[model samples]
Every structure is written in structure tokens, then in C-alpha cells.
Target: MDPWQAGLARELIMRLPAGADSAAAGSVLQPEQLDGWSDLDLHVDLPRSAEPVDLLAGLEIWSVTEEASADRQVLRAVITDGRRVDLVITGGGRVRLPDRAPDNHIRALVAQAAAKLGRGDRLIGLHLTLELVRHCLVQAMLLRDRDQGTTIHRSGSARDALADEIAGLDLDDLGVTPRPNVVERTVDLYARWRSELEPDYRPDWSGLRAVIDRGLAGR
Candidate 1:
């Protein structure tokens, strides 16, 4: 029997609206064995009439706070008990990975980095920088035809396993010393991978690239 806690999952499921359906995902779903650190990974599917924001509002009983909301496809949050909840909500359709999910995910981060940088917030910039690097690593793995779902669902060990296979990249411990350059380096790294993986793939990184370069010059 898995020792991991399912109380959170059960409670979350109970709170979901009548039309909503959910199942185990992430580490919790990979193996039946569970532990103290095993949180919940609930993939929720809502009927066409249901909305993620509405569902989130209902979660107020648990003092849930939204971490990020992107349409009805993704909803992440933290509960009052300090456990993180990642809900990938779909509109009655199954959640499927796109062929170029890495490409799409990276571009979104670049845009976010630009917005946060404009606000002159080092803290948010640092966070985005870290996320960018991580996504790039994952993207590279996807390009090589590895199991994208499992790799992302098991991020900690997945990163380690991929890192061992890819040589000479120094992905470990990209400290936030030169904050501006961190973003630049991450984008540059992604571009290199993108070029190798999909030669025809193109994204408008000029604007963000300019900003990152300008920041590096002043530093």
C-alpha cells in the first residue's frame, strides 16, 4: 500500500463541481508507493459549461491561492496547509501534449520575463529565469524523443537523468548573480537547441533579447 497522503486528493475531488472529473497524475500516479513528501497531482476535466476560475473560487474553503492561470488549460495553486496543487483543467477534452510543447512553453516564458523585467522586479525576474532554464532542459529532452510526459511529471529525477546523458552544459546551479544575463543565457541556450531540433522554427525573441542585452551592458 502506498504510504503517501491521499486526504488532499480526496478532499479536492470532493470539492470539485458535479460535472468535473479528476484522476491521479505526476509522481503520485506513477507508482502506488507513496511517502510523506508525495503531494497530489489531480488532472481535472470540466464540462464545457464549467470554468477553472469558478472552480478555483469554490476552493476558497481551503484558502487556496492561484499561482498561475492560463485559460482553462492550466491552473496551479497552493492550499492553506502549505501543500501545492497543480490542476491541468481541460474543457471535457483529454489533455494531450502538443508536438511542440517545449517551443510554445519557452516563448511564453520569454514574454513573461520581458513583462517582469519591465517592472524592474529582480525577485520575479529571478523566478522566471529559473523557470526558463528548467523548461529549456526539458525541451531538449523532448527534441530527442524521450517520454515528454514522464520526464516532466517526474521533474526532479527526470532532470538528473537527462543531465547525465547530455554532456558539457553546466545546467546545475545557475545562480542569480548577474540577474539580467541569466535570462539572456537561458534564451540563448534555448535558441541553440531550437535551431538544432527544428531548423525552421522561429519566434520573435528580438524584443526580449534586446532588453536582456541592454541590461547586461549596464551591469
Candidate 2:
């Protein structure tokens, strides 16, 4: 955890109205604490009568409109405290409130990779690297299908692009490579994602592609 980033997150949390509940923060880097170079993730439990947008009007964060989920109105603003904060406003009933939360499956995988890297476990690290990339690619594919209003299916171009991106990473220098069964493993995961969250709403693939491309480009 960066001390400066942690302080900035705390400052923004304190600025919220007194009644907000289930407000908490997390980071993509550590996944262990609300600390990282990437933007801070903040969730605020909203009251039924509250207007989420209006409440966030004064924040200086960029609005990540494309990434907003149906159940939450999300806004990203760069706070005066010198950190970008992602504020997710959701109804109280939809919020998950917990203390000492366990690492999500994805984060757990990332943490395991980091641990392996620390101990010079090259093979294990490579496996976890593929796991992480596969997870993200599957999520992107699912999101694409949901936006397209179609049954879950694979997009060869999109998957190939993702594979290219993964291959281009400096993982070899870090002592990792794609495992022998990487593709099959990815296929299995994709099938599971399709079964679990079949698209319920029509998605605009063209628009979704633009968003996905921008995200991949780190825009």
C-alpha cells in the first residue's frame, strides 16, 4: 500500500455525506488493502431517495460511463487529494458489507502469482499468469456478448487479440510462459462463464468493441 494513496482514499471517504453506508475501498495492485497505483475503488450505499449523480456532482473524477453496471451508477473523479477514485453508488440492498473480506477468485490468483514470483517458482507463476489473462479475456468476451444481445459465443478475433497482448507481455523475463493446456483451459472457463451468466440483455457489439479496444489500449 502506498501511504499517499491510502491517505487520499481516506480523505475522499470522509467527504461523503454522513449517512452513506457500506462505503469501502480496494485496490487492484495489492488486492490485500485499499492501496495501489491504479484508481481506487469506492462503493457508497445509497438511500432509496438519494440522487446518486447529484451527490457526486462536486467530485473531480472522470466518469467511466461504459463500465457502469446496470445496478450501480458509477463515477470516477480525480480528487483534490491527488488520487483518482472510482465511486460506485448502489442501493443499500445491492451492496455487500463485510469486514476483512476474502480475496476474490481473480485477485487470489494474482496474489498467488505474486507469491510464486517472490519464491522463484517459474512454472507456478506461468500457470497463474495464464489464469489471470484467461479470466480477463473471458470477462471481456462475456461483456461483449451481453452488449450484442446474443447467445454467448467465442469471438476468434477478440480472443486472438487478447492472446497477442498476453504474449507481448514481458513475462519471459519474469520467468513465465503459457502453459501447455492454456487454450483448452481458457475454453473451459469461457464455457463456464456462458453457462453462469447467459446474456439477458441485448448488447451493442460495435459500441462494446470500441469500449473494449479503448480499455485494452489503456485509455
Query: Model 1 segments beyond 4 Å from truth?
Result: 1-105, 114-120, 146-180, 212-219
Q: What's the distance in Å from true for residue 108, model 2?
A: 2.0
lDDT of 1 by residue, 104-123 (tens): 45554664454455445657
lDDT of 1 at 158: 38
Q: Against the true structure, whose lDDT is highest?
A: 1
Name model 2 segments beyond 4 Å from true: 1-103, 152-160, 175-219
How does each model score on lDDT? 0.52, 0.46
Query: Which candidate's TM-score is highest?
Result: 1
TM-score of 1: 0.35
Candidate 1, position 173, lDDT: 33
